[model samples]
Target: MEYRKLTESEIVELQNQGCVASNWDSISVHRQFNTAYIRHVNFSGDIKLGIYEKEFTLPGGIKKHSGIKNVTLHNCEIGNNTFISDVNNYIANYKIGDNVFIHNLELMYVDHESSFGNGIEVTVLNETGGREVIIHDKLSASFAYIMSFYRHRPALIHKMQEIVKLYTQQNTSNIGTVGNNVKIINTGTIKNVRIRDYATIESTCHLENGTINSNEYDPVHIGYNVMAKDFIISSGSHVEDGTMLTRCFIGQACQLGHTYSASDSLFFSNCQGENGEACAIFAGPYTVTHHKSTLLISGMYSFMNAGSGSNQSNHMYKLGPIHQGVMERGGKTASDSYILWPAKIGAFSLVMGRHYRNSDTSKMPFSYLIEHDDETVLVPGVNLRSVGTIRDAQKFPKRDKRKDPHKMDQINFNLLSPYTVQKMFQGIEVLNELLSTCGEASVHYTYRGCRIKGSSLRSGLKYYDIAITKFLGNSIISRLSNCPCTSDEEIREYLKPDSSAGLDKWRDLAGLLAPSTEIDKLIEDIESGRLTCIEDINAVFEKLHKDYYSLEWTWAWDKIQEYFNLSPDTITAKDIITIVEKWKEAVVKLDWMIYEDARKEFSLPTHTSFGMDGNKKDQKIDFEQVRGIFEKNAFVEAVLEHIKVKSKLGEDTIERLSKCL
Candidate 1:
């Protein structure tokens, strides 16, 4: 693609075709540039034009030749086979890439040097601005998690900030770029933005200082009435339908539409926001809300769902929105629920009704926080038997929409990880202490301003023991999967841990469930300037994610020894058989519980409106047709099959151990 000064005769032909140039000598064109396609276009200020010979067949079978018509360009370069038409204002100070189709654009320009949304400090979590995450195009949920939550380590924070600053400085430029194969149609007022390859911007309004990180693998889409400022929307994400954003970072494969608005927020992979509002929040992977009046403000959430009319108060009316809350992964809120800020919710917990009390359930996972008589009542370890919880865990990995090869977020959808299991361990200890101190005969107990009934406390203890038995059983069984252990020594050798990495406490660092010891090592590297590059930091996270299973086995083995009162050196096949028997019982009991819970969906009370104009038999037929019988339900069958499989596994292991005896 060579550019040459236009000939005198070619200039005359362009002039005859309603085209004008401020300086004829300043304009340059490709050697194969045709004057026949240039019509009614105004050009100025050092322009370069490419060969336009391709035909674009648009929707509705409209064939359009790639050419420039009815447009005004200033200090711009047009790429090969690109089409530009019907610009109301101008396209200036930008380079339009190859094969782009631009029509009905009002304004597109670069006024000054910009980093295109990189290094934009998004005030997440706390609105008064104590916690701010520097957003860049390659920002991952784990990266933002450490920066927003680990502000106490000033040296680490300073090193991380400086690394991001250097990257942003390298990206600063005066000339904006519209990459190859982009389509910008009926758009208005794009300023100081970088449009990457294969992006589609249709009918969008007012984008400023942003990066649309579109690629061939996963292109981004910005549809009608979308207005954003100081943002970085990653690949495969769609932000459209009257959504408004300011100072936000939208990670890969997220959806924001239906008039949803957010300010100073960071939404990571697979998160959805529709018909709601968010302010100063950190929404990690799988945080979703699809109802109106659901306001998420000054909160940190991951793998969470907000019900309709769910709200949280960030201000006590005394301070200026300085409070924040954390709902650990897999948390949910019932419709019309409310919580005051500075509260911490446990993993896989449910909240129902309004609660004025700031009860922190951080150490009690899988609990129900209910408002009864204006007091919070905690029901612990109930979600383990819930069919809905199992379904949610199964659906997250299946529903992942990210198609990018280089994914920014590393998400783990495992429900029974060390992070939650550690919480359950603490829960059992806490419940036992309460029983010993409050006396078993007492009817109710209170902790952290939340009431716990005596029956609930007993049930929690039983449930935790069963679940821990199930987990440890599963771990030991998996460890000795194919080992031919004929004697006690062989059994002990087979059950040895692969690594010692997971002996420390585990933390759910956004989506990755990893040991705190590993995270501390990463922090040390950052603070000591060994991991200065952002890519290097991300690589460490990826390695940690890859080694999760090896690390998990070590953690599970330690817990097994502690909970089952056995050492690897002294443990025998007989002891393993005992654990397996407990494991089999726990697995069978939980499956039956979940199976009974699923049956509730098909109960008679649920069939009230099924047969409105019919009798009892007709009602039965309608219910069976609509909801299906509980026996044939997919989840119910899976649960029953799990019981069969686990029971057989236990019996087989016991028989092998009997042979050893």
Candidate 2:
């Protein structure tokens, strides 16, 4: 982009075209710059202009050539064919790229050296100083997790901070950039923000000190009345509808709209937040909150849906707003549900009512925490039979909205992964301990500050056993799917663990579900400084996510040996058939339970409010018309289909194993 001095006649032509300049000698233009259609523009300091040879199509059918009108520039460089018009304040210290459009903006300027929101400390989770994560352009949820939660490892934190600081230093500049083909129209007070290629910013209120990591393939959108500061929004994200954010790192394809407000929060890929407020929360992939009264504050969550009026109290009277809670992946809250902080809810569980007892249900995945008589009642492992849980697991992979090739978050959507299975195993132990300590005939047992009734305890044990059998059977079938059982030796070989990494324990680090040993290896790498780069850490998470099934089989095999008291080397066809039979029973029974649960939705009590203005026969007709017959419902049909499919799968596998006899 070479520039030469403007000719005297060209300057006089620009003056005749109503282009005023404080110093004509300070202005320069490209070789083919023409003064056609340039009007009422004030140029100050050093300025460079490129040729405006292209025409732009307006919102309607009209086309107009690219030209500047009613604008002021200070030390700016305008690119070729760009349209700058009606800038009320000025465009200063900026480099506008080719084909960029800036129209009806109040002010767009770069005052001093800025990293554009990189290296801004976001105090996440614990709203205190110790857990601050310095957000950078490439900061992923996993990296922020380590920086915020693993603060005990000072050296690792220091190294990560140093890397971010280095990246920020490399990105620091005084000249703001508006990349090619960007549209910044009806914007107000855009200061020190770097607009990437093909970004569409329309009717934005304010954007300051941020990086819009947009590109041509997946352009970012900042629509009407959005206000942000000290943020780094990734590619393919849409922040609009009066959303306000500060010190936030918005991940790819996430949506924040409808007057949503967030501060000191990190929302990862595919998260949708509307009409709610988030503060100091680590919102991982698929964390959605759509209610106006929902306030997600001082918590860690992923794959979660906060129901309407869902709230959590982070501070007791004594803790100084320091307490935080965790609702592991796939957890959901019923409407108006609340939980006091310093509590842990299990994965895929449902929280129905307000609970202030600080219950910890981590070891009891897929359960329900209900409030009864001012006490929290735990119904453990019952959600394994829930149709909603199965639907959520099935839909997450299909609902992934991330279009960027380089995905920052590694999401694992497995419903029966080792992360939940291990919790089931431990839940069995805890339930048994409760039953043993308090007589099995006792009406209720208390554990973890939550009450469990005797009937619920018994049913919970049954449900957990069924789930364990199902998971083990699923793993065994998958393992032997390719390996033909020509002989007993091949069966023995197939039964052995693929890797030692999954034998002991497993964890869900937000959404990355893997064996604890793999997580340990990552932590050890960080401790040894071998995995210093954030990209390297993210690569480890991706690898673990990729090898999930293999590692899961390793964990399941060991658990099978422990649960069934059988050596894999000596197991006969009869034993395998017995396991398959158990799997069939478990699968059908759970599906039937879900079917019955679905039936409850269409019961007489449920239909009472539905047929409000009808007689008895008309009520029945109206209910059938509006809600449809229970048997013909979509979810009920799906449940019936699931039962048939799973039962057939079990029987087919058993028939395959019966040949080994």
Candidate 3:
């Protein structure tokens, strides 16, 4: 884009069109600049103008030509075919890009040098400090997870924060950027912000010191009274409807609206917040709270949903809001439920009532923490056959709205990965230990500040065994896929792990599931300076996410041997056939359980709400009309189909294994 000094005739024409400049010599115009389009504009300091030969086709088929009208610009470079009009205050020290539209804005400027919200330390989990995540444009959920969760590694934290600092310095600039194809209309007070291509900021209020990392493919939308400071809004996100944010990082495809207020929080991919408040929280992928009275504070969460009036207390009075909690992935709180801080809930668990204890059930996945007569009762391994849990697992992958080709968060949507399955293994040990210590005849047992009924204990054992069999069977079948299982040597060769990467424990690093040993190796690299930069760390996380399945197979093989008590070196087709039988039985049984759970939704009690003006027959008809019959429900049908598929898969595998005879 070449610019030339304004000609004498063009200067006269601009002046005649009600334009004023501090100094005529400081303004430069494009070679084909037309003076007819510049109207009632005041230019100060320096200006580089572009030609206005394009017309924008707005909503309702209105055509408006691109040009400056009734605006003041200072030290700005205007781009080609852009439109600027009705700015209440001047836009200063900004580089406006091509095809951009700026209209009816109050103030858009850069007062001083700024980093555009990069390298801002967000205090997450423990608000008093300690667990601050250094936020930047490239920050990922797993990256933030390690930074906030691994506070014991001072060297690692320092190294990562230093890398962010360098990035912040590189982004520091006196001139703010409004990139190509942007639309800023009816906005107020945007200062020290760097906005990228295709971002639509309409009716937004008070955005300062932020970076809108928008792209053409998946543009960000900030609308209707959004006020944000010290933030980074990632691609394909929305901040609208009077939402207020401070010191936060909103990740890709997330939705925050309906007066939601968030401070010192980090929300990763596909998370949502509406009509609620979040403070000092780490909301990983699919964490959602849509109710008005809900509050998520000082916690680490992923794949969890907060019901209406759900609240967590971080202030223990003595600690001064320092205590934090963990609700591991796939957990949910019933409406009006509460929990005290410093508590740890297990994966796929449901919190159904208020609890005052600092209960820790981290090892018990797929459990129910319900308030039975004001006592915290743990019904373990119940959610394994829950209709809602399976439906949630199925919905997560389908609900992912991220359209960006380069997704910042490496999310794993698998419901039964080694991360949760390993917890099941430990949970089995925990339940058995509790039953043994309390004596099975005692009727009720206590463990980790929660009560377990005798019947629930036995049922938990059954559920965990079924889930384990299903998992182990799936792994062995997948390993033996396409193999000719005719000999012991061939079967053992097929069952052997391709690598030893996943032999040990597994971790859910926010959303990415990988082996503990591998995560430890990466941490060692970071602490020892082998992974010196954020990009290097991110590259490792990305690689771990991509290699998850192969690594998972390695972990599953070891668990199979240990759980089923089989030596891998001498494992034969007969041993595998035995595992398959257990797996087939487990699969059929669990599916039947889930099917029964689904049936409960359409039971007699549920019909009460359906037929308000009719009798039982009308209730049945109305219920079927509104919610469909249970047999034809999409989820029920899917479950039925799934049972058929898995049953066939199991039978096929058994027949193939019998060939060894």
Query: lDDT values of the candidates?
Result: 0.92, 0.89, 0.93
Residue 365's lDDT in candidate 3: 92
Itemize residue pairs with steric clashes in candidate 3. none
Question: lDDT per residue, candidate 1, 499-571, as tens digits?
Answer: 7888869998889889999999999999999998889999989999999988999999999889889987798
Best by TM-score: 3
Separate clash counts for every candidate:
0, 0, 0
lDDT (C-alpha) at residue 322 in model 1: 86
In model 2, how many backbone clashes occur?
0
Quality of model 3 by C-alpha lDDT: 0.93
Query: Which ranges of candidate 2 are over 4 A from the true structure?
Result: 1-3, 22-30
lDDT for 657 in candidate 3 is 87
How well does model 1 score by local distance difference test?
0.92
lDDT (tens digit, per residue) of candidate 2 on 1-661: 7788989998899899888999988988898888896788999999999999899998988886888899999999999999999999999999989998888999999989999999899988888756898988887777777788787778877887887888889899999899999999899999999988999999999999999999877899999999999999999999999999999999989999999999999999899999999999999889999999999999999999999999999898785889999998899999999999989998889999999999999998999999999999999888987878888998899998877788888888888888888899899999999888988889999999899989999999999998899888888887877767766677788787776777788877767888878877888887787876767788888898889888888888888788888897797667777888988898888889888878888888777865578788888888899999999998899889988888888888887887788
For all predicted structures, in order, the TM-scores are 0.98, 0.95, 0.98
Count steric clashes of candidate 3: 0
Evaluate model 2: give its lDDT: 0.89
